[model samples]
Target chain A: MRWIWFDRFVEFESGKRAVAVKNVTLAEDHLHDHFPGYPIMPHSLMIEGMAQTAGILVGEARGFSEKVILAKVKRAEFFTLVRPGDTIRYQATVDGEVTASGASTTGRIFVGEEPVGEVDLVFSHIDKNMSGLEFPEENFVFTGEFQALLKTYRQQGGAKVAL
Target chain B: MPMSKDEIFDKVRATLVDALSVDDDDVRADATVMGDLGAESIDFLDIVFRLEKTFGIKIPQEELMPRDILQNPDYVVDKKLNAAGLAALKKAMPHADLTNFEKSPEIDRLAEVFTVGAIVKFIEAKLASK
Candidate 1:
């Protein structure tokens, strides 16, 4: 739900280096009561941010198929704290290819460079209906204007991003 | 997509013994993954990862946690569905309106397929367009 558009995307990328930013605003409901006068991003939310960042990587590695689910968190270390108004950077690498099931994919994640937190995740591309299976969709809500924003940003040469 | 119960169980057993180091005996139908075996949240998650890799499937957030197949004996659990699987769910189900299943009797009887591998094939078959 915290995932933003335009700004939280490939603001800059070149196969290896990519920079995505999430502007922490007081408008966030969590910031309202996190500490009255002080608003610090929760550690877990930081990981979610990392997950979103990593999610984009997976989307790029493969096509942006809705099937890919961030499956596992191999490792994550939090060394600092993320507060409102700060933009966290999620950097990753294509360590190698993973051949599981009957498909081959590149596994990757964000290693927190500045030190707040980093996540080692594995994403799997899957089918929506396997059996009588239904998953919780409450946590994930796509911002309605995401695609439009992406298109608009493309027009602006990826320079202006409103917080 | 409809794999037999024996085949599903065999795959589940392999994931347990091979990936998680759990004994084959511990992976039975009524095995009680988190309830009886003391498998922590992380352990269950790791098992889910093993399932995905082993079966080429993904478990979405909504269905992954509740389907307690290792504990429940009645339901034959399958892999966690992805977008395609979800589409298949919406397509194949004549009563596609799932607005009521949340409160139906199947809620309790529903056996969660904890591992991604165990449920994918089963789900594919189950959700295939009939």
Candidate 2:
């Protein structure tokens, strides 16, 4: 299964905030075994959705130069279960300055107008922060597929977004 | 007015509690951040972010951990910090009490230097400098 969680970037304000939407469906294979009858969306996947939403924002802030990996989930609290047909909206905002070492983001998940969860994440710029470790020279974190999401967003008249 | 050591410690304690998900009682001054508080490398960045937000001060990663000195070949010898490395660490982290670490400068034991009290001291110094 593809790891991409969110379906598309609905709103993106580079370096500051971004909003992405994920449409949950019964066709997702994992939901079938998660509970035969219930088939409720898992909270873990919601966290991954938030991670992708915020991780992209953090990565784009630096022009996707650094391998922005989700280093830590400071907090992930869910208020309700998401089911099939629920449109999960992830709104992520950079908490402060995206330093060379890493960036911190606060995300709010919503199903329509109802608040579902909040996930605070910390992203490390491995190239800059991991002193002794060596990563691949190519920008592996923001692969073509991920960059294409941003490209499509920009093409969709998101011209105001700062790259 | 500058924040006192006690005030700094309280905030630092709260930051660690939030960053590491530890109970308030567990955040003792003598407790090592890694060993006692169970803070991994990633948590250090989380702590830095929270501390920056809490205290409204900038903490360059190097100032807190000094990974550059630890990784430098000139400073490390046989998986331990040589005299030069120890000196560099001491200079980098004046807020940390390295008296015990100085005895055995093993690369592995470096995390022991990051006690709750040491963090409090680091914040106290940073706030004073601002």
Best by DockQ: 2
lDDT tens digits, residues B84-106, model 1? 43444334342223343324334
Residue-by-residue lDDT tens digits, candidate 1, A40-136: 7776666566565555555544334344455656566777666767766655543333222112222222324455565566555434322345645
Candidate 1's docking class is: incorrect
| Model 1 spans > 4 angstroms off | A1-6, A10-18, A27-29, A98-113, A128-145, A157-163, B1-130
Cα deviation in Å at residue A93, candidate 1? Answer: 3.5
lDDT of candidates 1 onward, in order: 0.48, 0.89
Q: Residues A18-129, candidate 2, lDDT per residue (tens digit)?
A: 9989999999999999898889999999999999889989987888888999998888999998999999999999998789888999999999999999999999999887
RMSD of each: 11.7, 2.2
Please report how far candidate 1 places residue B53 from its true position, in Å.
11
Give the range of the ten consecutive residues with the poorest summed lDDT in model 1 chain B.
B109-118
> How does candidate 2 fare on TM-score?
0.92
